[model samples]
Target chain A: MAGLLRRDMLGVALTVAAIMLPVAGAQAADPIKVGVTITQSPPGSVVQGTQVKDGLEVAAKIINDAGGVDGRKIELVIEDTQGLPEKARAAVEKLATRDKVVAITGEHQSSAALAGIEVAHRYKIPYINTNGWSDVIREKGYPEVFNPGNYNSRVGAAAAATMKELGVKRVVSIAENTDYGIGLAKAIGEALKKIAPDVQYKYETLDRASKDFLPAILPMRANAPDAIINLMLPPAAYIMMNQLYEQGVAPSAKTWLYDGSGLADYPDFWQNVKEAGKGMLVFGLYHPKMAQPALGKQVGEAYTAKTKNEPNRLLFQAADSLFLIADAIKRAKSTDSGALIKALGETKYTGTRGEITFSKDKGYAFNQWLDVPYVTFQLTEVNQKVGDSALVSQAGQPLDPAKLWKPAK
Target chain B: MSGIDVDLAVNGLITGVFYALMAIGLSLIFGILKIVNFAHGEFYMVGAYAYTLIALALGVPVWIALPLAFVVGALLGWLTERTLMRPLYAGYTSWGLMRDEYAVIVTFGLSLFLINFVDKVIGPYAYRGPPLVETSRVVLGPVLISGHRLLAAGIAIAVIAVTAALIKWSFWGQQIRAVSQNRLGASLAGIDTAKASVIVFMLSGGLAAFAGALLSPVINASPDVGIFPAIKSYIIVVLGGMGSVPGAIIASLFLGVIESFGAVYISFQYRDAFGLILLMLFLLFRPQGLFGEKGREV
Candidate 1:
């Protein structure tokens, strides 16, 4: 009877061991899935979306080609947001619940990002914000949410400093009616009050979808400000610039055209706005002259090779987002949401931009890389690339007024 | 006022002219069919894409692409009438019993389908159609307008004039007018009512598409680019009276100038709101509009 019992126990142990072997092998071979949400269709900035997608793909290829994390491949499951808030919400929910993505990333629009993070927070998934600029995103205080992108306050402070250097007494900002635009516009107002107290400033909110902005721009013709700041994105920004130039408002001898939205990096910028972009001051996040980390150079080279287009700021931000997620997964050694979140919090990864580390402070500083670098530049000629443009100032540096160029009246 | 004010006024008027072109087609459709063509904007969108893709992608010249855009719009209009609109007047010869609700739903759905389809197929990036002239800017008195805009405006005016004349004196024009007035009576008088509706839809679609092609360089062609123009067209149709082309033209210019001046004087933030407010006032007080006939209930 003892011998028969021993045989049965041995058989049960063999069966258990056989089941565990395949499960372990499958774990080693399975790919880590990362979800990306972007506006691939109408009503969104497809230009920005395409750039983000390209950057993410390039980074994914680099990881996979390098044997991936722990010998497992990185697979991107992309969902098109169409730049709608409801679509973003649904997409994040679907990605987290059904696709079982380890991390959620690649949201460019602020409104869409705002909606997407809510779902990510609910699911306790790590969200790496790619390009949403609104400070309100970080202020939401979601532990799962992390930002490695430019912020509105950063651009606002830069614009204020540029305006002060240009000796502009009066300024006007034409902002699109969105969270990013309006938030930046307000931030500029606040920053101006602090840095240039005597400077007069105001902002006008324009519908992002509306083509006509003449009425808003025409009023400025009579009492043109010293500088007209653009807080809108393309193609609306392109239209506004054209109309402003046509009316001889900005980029003229009297008034300077300042683009706070960083419009100079877009590939279509020159094609749409020919002469309107000349002599325009831009709040740029990426410039060739600006100091970048070694990782940034590698990512830039990879992006240029893959897309055959100049690497812009969005590319670095998007690449860093994916790279950071992959790094956290590696550190965690598991795709569990709890473990990944803890690993992401302790990240000191040197991504494409800089040594990115999330802040522990509350509000807008929460989970944000507080010292993201930026620069201000000027487009001295038509169809000028950001690489060749005149770099007016570096991060936290003073703009040299002598180096600036203005149109002759 | 500064020289810039005059420039704004002239540019505003030019924009108004394009708006009139789009609005007139919508007005005509409403006049004849008594139903708003919600897909009117899609027709314009198609024309813009057709002109841009043909000129840029296929290496066709700008002039040839412009006319081709019109043809594309007309064909789309014809197809829309044959497939979707036929159900409205298919079995019923009588005018009063036409399925107006069905027409609205079909056109609205068609509009959605076209927008999404373009987004999926052509991609969503806005392509600025090549200009007729390569000249970037030309100074005309106080105004400094793009050379392409000046030339396009001239063509638009000529096309609008030709459309008005065709609708007034041509044989088909008279039949269309008769059908719009009293479809049953026109049918009894040996006029082919169905044929007239087809012609009107085609003309309307063609004109809107022509406007889209002409302005594509300035507006840039995208999947939902036609939405703004369609809204403005709806407002112009109501302001000019439901079916009057001349009324639409006058109203378009007036709205444009008012919006331009109001935006500057009141608040630039509410520039689009001015049109909506005007529309509301017109609906509340004068539903018949500036040139519309008073209701005569039978």
Candidate 2:
């Protein structure tokens, strides 16, 4: 009886070993999967998503061309977030659990990023934030999340500095009713208090979906402020600017139209706001005059060649996100999530933007690469490209107020 | 008060004129159909896209694009009536048996479908329609306004006036009024109630689209742009006494002025809330509205 049982156990063990051999061999040869969540449809900013997707694809191609990481191809598993938080959460869950991606990336909006990171945290997956600017995303202190994109605090400080340089006493911000908009508005107010204590700061939260902003802008006509800061995205932002211009409010000799939301780089910026965009000061994240890494130039050229449009800061940031993930995968030598997360923590790769390195500090600095390059540029003429615009400042340099031009009344 | 007060009032009135153009058609539809067409905003969206795309893509002049938008909207209205709305009125013997709940659900679904369809097909980027005039800004005494806005307002007034006149004296207008007064009685009197409903829908769709096309230069064309205007139209429809064209015009102007003044004096944040608060008060106190006649059921 004992001999017969031993023979049966040996036969079952041999069958299992035969099955495991092929599975193990296939696992070794399988591709490394990276998850990307982006808004490809309405209610979300599809423009931002399309740019990010292009940048990511370019970076992936670059990586794949030079012999994929450790003999395994980098596979991008994309899911559409539709710019909604609930949808983002579900996309992340599907990517993490169903697809078994090594890392999650390509979230553009802050609200969507905020929701996605929660699921990434649950599964201990590394999430490379593409363009979400809210500080709350960092404040969460999730170990698995990393932000290579711009932050609201940085933009707020830059805006406050510009306002102080311009010597504007009263400032009003027309912010979209969103986490990114409200956070940046508050950050700007706080920064202003520290630098220009006498400046009066206030912001009006407008619905992003609403077309009519005359009701909101008309009230400001009575006592237009010294400066008007736009902290909203396109379409809505363009409408608001036009209405303000039509009302003879901002961009006039009295009030300065300062854009901290980087509207000048948008492809439709000139087409939408022809007259209103002139004499506007823009807080730009990328300028052609600024020093660029070889990777950035390559991606920019590729992007321009494909879309026939000038490459913006988002393209560079998005490209760097994918590049960094690929670099980590190469360094880790495996597609295992644990290995990728550890390698991302020690990321030392130079991406299209700069030498990307995740910080060890907590809060907003957690896994964030500090000293991301930025510049301030002014749109001196209508339909002027970002490359042709006058660079007022570069990467922590003070903007020369004397170089700025004001409109003639 | 300073000169800014006069500027604000003029600007507010001009905006009120545009709102009235959108609301009057919705009011007419509610008067006859007795159901709020939630898809009313999509009609505006469709018109804006039609005018902008036709002018920009096909290189059609703004003059031609404006009327073309109206025709497109009218066609959409006709299609909506023939397909979705027919289920509500066709083969129904009694008004009590009419399925209003189903109409609301179907129209709401249509609104969602149209918005998503446009977003997917045209891409999500907002397109600013070409202006009628190249003039950017014009200063008239104390008031300053955009040339496009002034031109659009003038067109809106003319359209509203013509629409009002048509509804007042035209043969089809009287038939529509008769149907709204008593659907069963009008049917008994050989007034094809279904045909009257179809005409009302076409007029409603055309007016909403015209408003959208006129404002495309100022607002830009987007998928969800109609949502706000649609909400405003609903409020104006109720405040203006459901089916009363004159009442809608008055209510739209009143709401616009109130919003403009309240935004400045009170809080710009609560600008949208003022309309809702007024709507609540009207519903509580004057359910029949300013011009709606009280009705009794047998």
Candidate 3:
């Protein structure tokens, strides 16, 4: 009787193991879906979107080539936001609920990012902001969101410091009517007030959709400021810059044109601006001469190999964004949102740019990689590449006026 | 007037010249078809891409590429009229009730199609067309302008004059005008109304495309680059008079000058709104527009 009872229990245990083994194998073989929201088409910046997409793909290829995280492949489910808030909200909702992605990332535009984070927060999914520079994104204090990209305060302080070093008394910002543009404009104002109180600063918000800016620029010709800061993005920024140059308002011997929006790194920058871009000061997050980690080199090489174009800051930020997600998934050992969020919070991973660790501080610093490096440079010639441009200032260094070039009126 | 005011006026007039280029084509289409062609802006967008790619990618001379853009746009307009617009006129007489709805839906669809098609085929990167001249800045006393812009403005005035003359004197233009006045009467009078419609579409497309090619150096040609111009064209069409060519030209210049002055004096932020406000006033008070005759249907 004892032998028969033991044999039956062994038979039941064997049957259970047979069912569980295949299930485990299938789970290990499954691809981990990461949601990506970007403006694949305009009226948003498709250039930025394309760059971010390329970077994410490069990072994904690297991860998968080396046998993806914990024996599972990484699959990106992308949705087009078209840089509209309503579209972004819908995209995030679709990504979180419908697609059931583990995490969401690759949002470059600030207004879209702001809208996307709300849906991510409600769904309690981890969101990695790629290149939205608005501080309000961090100020919202959503635990689900993590900013591994540049923020407005950092650029504001940099621009202000550059202005102070250049000793410009009056500065004007031609900002677009978007959160990123307006926020950075205000941020620069705040920073200038703190560092150079005597300097007069004002920003004019322009419609991003409008093609002409001659009217706004005409007034500047009457009594041009000492310096003009560009807080707008292309192609509006390009038009504004051309108009500014045509009106002899900025970038002249009397006034300087400082680009706070990192427009110099764009592939179409020279093609669009041409002579207008010459003698312009740029607040750049990535210069070919800047010191980068091994991971950065690897990503840059891979990107150049894939695209034949030079690697820009958005590429590194986007790659880092995806790498951070993969790192969190590896540390957590699970695809669950709660586990991923917790793992991401305690992240100390070295990404493409550098060792990225999220800050615990509130406001703009919350969950942000605070020490993202930057440099200041000047474009001295028309149709000049960013590599050939003179680096006026290195990261964590003061601007050298000797290295700067001004247009002789 | 102050130097700035003179600057504003000169710049405004130049801008108005380009506005006239876009508005004239739209005005012509409305005059003949009596239904708005929503894809009018896409014609401009296509011309922009055509000119930029021909000059930049194919290494064609800017002068040749400029006219080629017009030809491409005209071809597109012909094709659009042949395939999409014919259904509105063919196999249906007195279909005025469905005309507006059908035209709207079809043209709107075409606009979306063209935008997405260009975005996919050429990619989303903006291409700035090469300037006609290498001179960056041209100063005329108080006025400062790009050499390319000055030349383009001059070309625009010439084009507008030629177009107006053609409409007033050309044989096809008279037929188009006849069709505009009374489609049924023109058809009964042995005028090839369909041919007239086709010609108007082609001319409209060509003119809009010409404007686009001319401005591509300044605007940077992209998929959605035509959207703003299209909006401006719409306002000008109404403010000038829906189907009056002379009215469109006058209104275009008027709107441009007002916006330039309003931007500096009133608020730069409200520069675009100034046109819309004028459009509203025109719609409410002068529904017939500056030159449009009220209750003129035969």
DockQ for each model: 0.53, 0.62, 0.84
Evaluate model 1 with DockQ and give the value: 0.53
Interface RMSD of each: 2.3, 1.9, 0.9
Q: By summed lDDT, which 10 consecutive residues of candidate 2 chain A come out lowest?
A: A210-219
Candidate 2 DockQ vs. native: 0.62
lDDT of 3 by residue, A1-409 (tens): 8999899999989999899999989988999999999999989999899999999999999999999999999999999999999999999999999999999999999999999999999999999999999999999999999999999999999999999999989999999999999999999999999999999999999999999999999889889999999999988999999889877887899999999999998998888888788999999999988889999999999999999999999999999999999999999999999999999999998888788999989999999999998889899999888888998987668877866777766
Candidate 2: where is the Cα deviation over 4 Å?
A: A1-22, A334-338, B293-298
Q: What is the lDDT of residue A57 in candidate 3?
A: 97
Q: Candidate 2's residue-wise lDDT over B151-256, tens digit each?
A: 9999999999999899889999999999888888899999999999999999999989988899899988888878878999999888878888899999999998
TM-score to native of every candidate shown? 0.93, 0.93, 0.97
Q: Name the top DockQ candidate.
A: 3
Rank candidates, lDDT, best first: 3, 1, 2
User: Candidate 1, residues B132-249: lDDT per residue as tens digits?
Assistant: 9977678877667778889998898899899899989999999999988888888889998888888888888998898889988888888899898899999999988999889899
**What are the per-model C-alpha RMSD values against the true structure?**
2.7, 2.6, 1.8
A1-409: candidate 1 lDDT, tens digit per residue: 9999999999999999999999999989898999999988778888899989998998898899999998999999999998899999999999999999999999999999999999999999999999999999999999999998988888888899999999989999999999999999999999999999999999999999988787777668778999999999988998888878866888899999999887899988887788889999988889988888988898899988887899999999999999999999899998899999899999899987779999999977888898898888899999899999998888888998778999988
Worst 10-residue lDDT window, candidate 1 chain A = A213-222
Question: What number of clashing residue pairs does each candidate have, in the order they appear?
Answer: 0, 0, 0
> How close is candidate 1 at the interface, in terms of C-alpha RMSD after superposing the true interface residues?
2.3
Q: Residue A116 CA error for candidate 1 (Å)?
A: 2.1
Question: In model 3, where do residues sit more than 4 Å from their true spots?
Answer: A1-20, B95-98, B296-298
